[model samples]
Target: MFKNILLLLCMTALSTPAFAQDHAAQNADIAPDMPAKFTVNTDKFDFIRRDVMIPMRDGAKLHTVILIPKSAHNAPILLTRTPYNATLMTSKAESGTMRSVLQGYDNMPDVIADGGYIRVVQDVRGKYGSEGQYVMNRPLRGALNHTKVDHSTDTWDTIEWLVHNLPQSNEKVGIIGVSYDGYTSLTALINPHPALKVSVPMNPMVDGWMGDDWFHNGAFREEMLSYIYNQDATAKKTAIWWGNQYDNYDLFLNSISAGALGKERGMEQIGFFRQLLAHPAYDSWWQQQAMDHVLADLPLKVPTLLVHSLWDQEDNYGAIALYYALKQKQADQPNLWLAMGPWNHGGEIKEASTLGPIKLPSDTGLYFRKKILEPFLAHYLKDDAVALPQRVSAYRSGSDDWETREALPARDCTTDCTTLHLTAKYQLAMNGSAETSGSVSYLSDPAHPVPYVQRPVITRGAANSAWDNWLSTDQRNAASRPDVATFTSPVLTQPVSLDGQPLVHLTATTSGTDGDFVVKLIDVYPDEVPEQRELGGYQLMVSSDILRGRYRKSFEHPEAIPANQAQLYQFRLPIMNHTFLPGHRIMVQVQSSWFPLYDRNPQTYVSSIFTAPPEAYKPATITIDTAKSWLTVHTADVATP
Candidate 1:
């Protein structure tokens, strides 16, 4: 038996190598023939697409895609630098026509295709196909940023390359974008290149802490967490926001606190999240990055067209703020222009005939592109193009028409403004002051905060999310809440037009050491609308804002509120250009919390609200002095452009 076993083992081992050799020979014989490279034929296409790696001043290569019309020669270049993937922005469809591929965000297909302009879009450093490290709105080369290169230097390098490399293009270049890309367009203005003749920064992000994406006053905009996670977690934004719950209200409520929620979602791994955790106040880190402050000292050399949206949800504070900042310093410069439109953030690219239930007289988006943007660009970039005539073009909401002016607000708002007083009877009066004796009080529970919009509060950017037109939502939902204090003005017999920022002054007291106050300026429609039945009694929000009580003393240094004592809190809402028609009524609603949109204030003071314990959040009684609260709005006579 032993001899038989030894013979079997030897036979198996000898046959194994013979079988392996036979298999290897078979694999070599059947090897597939495939080409390593192939060429794409473009004779049938009307546009030429060139993808190149643009070298920056710091040696980092940014991915850029340029689209040139087949019949083009010496055509001016229109550029957009964005952190959002340039490949996605420039490639919308698989078609031979250039217009078909450029029909997405931040693009006007008709203007680009018909006007014969070469279109270019690039990925900023460290985003998408670009090579470098990523930083959220990287500060300029100074104390904050230890690096030698910034967005300004990168833009200068890019423009230098484009003019020299592109033989089918004119030397003139124009930069334009919305939001983050808009922010990049603004950066190009700092020590701009000779080729950069025009810039259009539409709804740019000027400041994160003051009123932009991250925070408003001192309250953290909690809804923007998903954006930070998705944008910063990976280079390709591969990290998905795993929000298991359908309603964001429940998702946020169940988490107890923003800090706790962030931890549970693994936000500790992101750099921006760590920075957000480190700085919860308006410190030097945030102040130095504000574009309004940074551009105040720089010269306004290029012809810049500042486009502001009346209902811009993400960046309502940016373009307007930067415009005013630059205007204060360079008021005499004719190159600086302003155009205020009736749309949401980046809404100029879409069909802007109406927003929600409110309808406009014309397609304002089309009018803007043909009449305002095209002319503005042509005059600067094209040699034979006619010059633009208007310096300021603003759209009036209630009138549903465009108005041109030499200056904004049409008049000096400080001297021509009207003050509306809030009386103890819950009436908005033009003459009588607020009641000196009594006050309005309500119970504010953190467990049951006021919703920013009607619930089933879906996550932002989700399918059918209310983020697009939440600014135009009916105020009745908030006014009906028990915690919200409502004050209404008598129906206007004649039209009253507001053309500037609305200043809010509230004298209030809270039972807790820390709290939040939300003030909303609404335009309440008449009880009946025969033409549009669904619009009847629609309480539209014209302008609104919020301020954390801790920052009442100072934005830099927060202090606890003296409980049960009347303290005056004053802040400015976003700018507005609306007319309260004869039958419309003006209403102001004040509340303690605007939830999930902004994180819930602990109501009790702690060193840092971001790290506040769950027990710190408690119910409190809030009181508003009726006689002391008043709203001041700038009025203008309605006129057509």
Candidate 2:
């Protein structure tokens, strides 16, 4: 078992390496020199790096890497804890602790190169070199028990140990991380050590059900299944690489079954996968896993900087939801601030200014790091008073400029509610006449689920580059599908800007007992678009969401819908800061399934969707009542682009 775990860890390195496939030459048998280039300038710097096992409160030792610059006079400490290996190399190259130690500082961001600080990175319990069992987004403990310790205690112990043991320490410490690492950074804030003065939890995993990793508004995230298991030894004996299949949609539909995933694929061996299978609904188990309750109750001991991307695939709702939760506690003068951009996942920290073909207004990642992140850390940790961003600093997609606000959603921004009715003629009209009342219907067959993206996709996990840019990819591929119902507004004569979330209300009836409704708000480019651009007639999905019919009334208690009965289902899509320019058209697409992106809804009600049999899958005709079904959008009159 030990040998198998180590083999898995060494094989499936940090999710998917952005370098692996790109450098794989057409005829070359050997892979490229990736490990050497992962972290550059290591030889030029006098930073002394060491690997150590730090004992936690429970006597379990966590594998940690400490790097202190030899030229440092007195420096502050910055710590990041990650489930991904603390060192750089991909899993294929990770041989042993000795190999990683010899590699020196690899895969760290360039900002650290201008270091006047002590940097530390560590693997959480049960991951990589750390000892003890691993738990996904472990729940916060109420009080410390002698028998057990949570992530909070582990963090406090690590910080306490670092402050005392490390020389040339100024005692002040800061924390920051992205994705899973971001979760650890956020966890460190719960009863934080006195020396921990500042933090930036960028794109943290806040909740599983609400719009992060696993589930989105009760809809199962199918792509994450292969992601979670392959990345960790807790789930699989070794990483399962589904080689570059020409058509991923067909690959998933024909190969994987949500009901039989555990029985057929041996997913039962994975602890968290077992727990996910057991709890289909948002029950006590999921509630206990939620971080919102814990975040709202936290004392504002350290000033926090919440960084997020407007298009973050993994944790889009995390930073926003956390901002709202933190605001509830600090209504008077909040210490929490937000910096949002059009980056993917942790792209705000990377050098990428463009996602796919959509170019950002400016170098958002660099601006945030220099103007917001660095200033915030320096001010709190090093007593450096620099002009840092205040309250909210968000990038406006259409305008291509950063907008600062006193609060998120902008305090002074007035919303003009516009309703686009789902018309009988397969059109989205701003105003509907009495005679235009009719229904539009489509057959939603479970055997042929709708594909979320164009097929032949080479990537697998959400951590990969492809998954990061899928949110803004052109939706024209799925638009022509018979299963997808697209309603479009005539080309616009004036510009329309949206600053907040959109609400999708539908009065619909299905042929089966259960179904999923996917709503997408799109901006259609003009026909005479530039050749090099994202293009004319490009359908960019600005905001989208899915609602499981059974959970319409309550997420905790799901009830099957009455077949052929008109039921009103409504849910808010993720927020956006996009503007539909003149000569563009607004489109609303309604569909039953998003394919492998989300697990196919059985359409027939069962005890649990995860355990439903193959026979339960059926075809269903969904009809949208024209008069009652309309998408409500929040638009602002501001025309400054």
Candidate 3:
């Protein structure tokens, strides 16, 4: 991995290459290189920290932390629906976690309360601090989003109770949250609660089954998600610092594997375990409460704001797909607005932003985006603050700048939605054909997984942890390694925008009975000096996946890999809303296992998604018909010069 990183540092993403840039100087700022800084006020909004039991429809009491302005006798309602403990308020947290940003500003109380408004934060049913047995990924059974009740029905009931019961005015409420909170906010729109108005699901993951958190193409994100619930589900009513490794730094930092904590704490909630073992295929269980299923009843709910990060690494793809769908449904209803930023699923620290351990200006600086969010609420519940213009704005990668459009990305979605056919190793480069032959392959060990930072789930408590599986080195870099396979294209003379789902189509026979087929779409720019810190320049990972070789043909059933058989292997990875700009090359990286990040697929197709030991794993030969096998991507024609 360091060797891969070393090569990356030398090549650089933006410039004077081969002669080499100073690696020591270049590597330091790789994380906070893109300098966008702001300020913050770390003082906590001393709202009446009252622990009230918000009665669910099932008559079960769920805990809520109401952080109303101490000064406000009458204020508007700013609600956050969370699955993590509602009591998990930060003593040092000022801006809000990435999850808080998704759910809506945690600073609503301070932002508007100074302006005079109340922030009502509620924990969802069956999770931390809330009463009832927790069901991981519970479908919205009834109107509420719960097993017996559901979020839609439960939320409506809560709003009804809070408005009448809690001390507030205007009877107006706005829902917000990220990940689970985003789901909860979406539920607020579905079947429309009359009192609920205005909402923002930041980097929200709408579909539990298909593209978000739990699984993608039947591949479960075993470590990040499970590790988190274990620590959190078993924790006491105290706020721990998120965004780093495990709960105990000494243990994780000392090179302890993730399993040690679960065993030490004896924290077997089994919520996640049941989720992993239960569904091997995309079943009705996952489909039941997906946003797509309930979109017909989606309410406009006062003005809704959709904030997603292009590099969100977690929920953006799923959320963006759902956002476009919702925009189409509510085309006539001028209530939806989309904002995409450069931050990860939660918030990636800015280069110059002030932040420290104890939390002061740094803590406050974290919430600046939350401050930007203040105006949205001020207008709706309080009927004040100037309104924002243009419903859509997205930050573009490579260019490292923000772009805004009046309408959705019609130019890309409509015009650039051309399908590229996948045959073997070489992909038709827009108007051209492949230069290289053979398939792109790599070794994906399930144990020593890579790292997924700068995206969401940089910490455990983040709402989306799906992409954590790709936490390792680049597949192209990995392909450069003997254990992997590489398929490269000559750097494009014309810029291409890979704006949608990138597909890998192949007809190959695998050796050693059965194995998985993994595909990664990568953007390789002209090597330059590592600007901020990513050495060897940065080759941003567009999307990736590992299709269980056994389930290569079907997700529902499993089959064996006949030795050296010419069976078809097709992998449709997560979507990529990216622009592979000019002077950059597009490469495909293929590898088998993503290590401990994702559970290992015992080269032989198996009934279980996990528990495949290392002995069961063996190097299998996957034939990529270079001349016949090809990869396809939804790319934009280079804008005619």
Candidate 4:
């Protein structure tokens, strides 16, 4: 269950601060009550007088760690409901054990205690101390034996109990959390108690679709996230799933082929890990779990501040898609303001001062507490003079600069869509508006396929790992191999903005009835300078994805190709917020294998995505449809609002 994700590991120490007094500074200010110094009641603060048991309507009980502020005055309450074991939330269940030194506890207790608020942490149902059978996705249904409860239902019930029992200010409650807890924050809003007025879902789950933690267009994430239900506490009933859940992943690695499991590579996996082999197509199994379809089921009456990471190695992309989708829905009632940074899953980016070679003034976390949580809580709950405003800032890895936009990126366009003909001789060019054509070829061997860059080195589960950079490396580097094909673009004299996802159209013939088409979007940088850091000091990998040649026509059910017969394939990759500068270059690398990243295509039409034994994979060439194949990207002009 230990995944090495990039969740806000960013570390921005109090170094030289940015002096550019921008608008973020104007409206996004700290509370006047911020103390120059503070005190932590180490004993009372650290001690959980008792392990409180919370009950849900479904006859289920939840285990919680309640930390009361030293103040006897009934003030507002701040709660964080997490799945990462209640013990890790705040203070220390026991020191020098799982955590080093209460992880900046002084900062946490200082913030909440200073406000005279009670902080509580609960192990989500089916995880850690909480009781309930542990299902990774935690199917909307409770467990096989326990009371059934869903996220929305659980929070609604949880708040109902807190308002009456806690001595806090009458029913006035504030909820804040990140990742799974972030999702809980938003989930609370949909079916919230009257006391739930202000909430923040930081880098929350939008739903599993194009941006879900895993399975981007049927592509499985290589790393597996283990459902290590170390402990489960429910209604005084408890169950712990024994040992390390992830270590046995190998036993099920091939389970996809046996029609015995579901992909659990990322958040999307959380919803349907059990059906990985069953639902190769976006059938009812996946569609039902898709949160986008269920937002209508939400009662989003509370004011909300949504936060996501721009370079989050995990759920940000999906959350971004959700933000735009909700904005377009015209249901702005929640005033659902959004904030995006360059952080990761668990604030990893915030703790990391550098991204590869780029040394940030501070990990994106510097402004996290000050610019986001603090101002948000002040404006909504405390009615402070300074309120937080809607923010849309993207950190460009190349320039080490942050660009602010008035609004989110709704849509954009490309200046041109050019087709390059890949002759046998390796020539490249943009065909005229009329029609241009050429071709390239490479072999895809199931036996020796391309591996997911991060799989072997790191555990292949969890969508937000620091290892995500593995997905974006230059494809050209892959082209040097005999099995992969590479295509280059003429150096541009002007900047090219690829602000949205791109579509690749290819015409090809497979040696067998099935195969796959892999396309990578690469940013070829400029000539390197010695001291200034290399052109690719960032190795800024943009995006890459694979498409089952058979599913090129429909995602529902795929149709295999006629052996030795040529065919056309089309696939779309995730969107981007980028501007390829004048001096830079663009390169597209195409491959057949993305490794454990996606199940290997058997090169034979089968019912599942991974329908093969290691030996069943045959070497086949992906003949490029030169005259017919083309890559198109959506570009935008820099005309600021």
Q: Which candidate is the best by lDDT?
A: 1
Task: Give the alpha-carbon lDDT of every model.
Answer: 0.88, 0.77, 0.56, 0.58
Ranking by TM-score: 1, 2, 4, 3
Measured by C-alpha RMSD in angstroms, how accurate is candidate 2? 11.3
- Count of clashing pairs, candidate 1: 2
Q: Output the worst ten-in-a-row residue range by lDDT, candidate 3.
A: 351-360
RMSD of each: 2.8, 11.3, 17.6, 16.4
How many Å off is the CA of 100 in candidate 1? 1.0
Scored against the true structure, residue 431 in model 4 reaches a CA lDDT of 53
Worst 10 residues of 1 by lDDT: 429-438
- Stretches of candidate 1 above 4 Å error? 1-40, 410-412, 431-437, 639-641
Which scores greater on TM-score, model 3 or model 4?
4
lDDT ranking of the models: 1, 2, 4, 3
lDDT of 1 by residue, 197-269 (tens): 9999999999999999999998998899899989999988999787989989889877877888899999999
- Model 1 misses residue 388 by how many Å? 1.0
Query: How well is each residue in 56-140 modelled by candidate 3, as lDDT tens digits?
Result: 7778888887655556665677777776556654233445332232233333324544555566777776666777655544566
Q: What lDDT is obtained when candidate 1 is compared to the true structure?
A: 0.88
Worst ten-residue run, lDDT, model 4?
A: 227-236
Q: Candidates' TM-scores?
A: 0.94, 0.87, 0.72, 0.76
**Candidate 2, which segments miss by more than 4 Å at Cα?**
1-44, 89-108, 142-147, 234-238, 241-246, 410-415, 431-436, 459-465, 531-534, 637-639
State, as a TM-score between 0 and 1, how close model 4 is to the true structure: 0.76
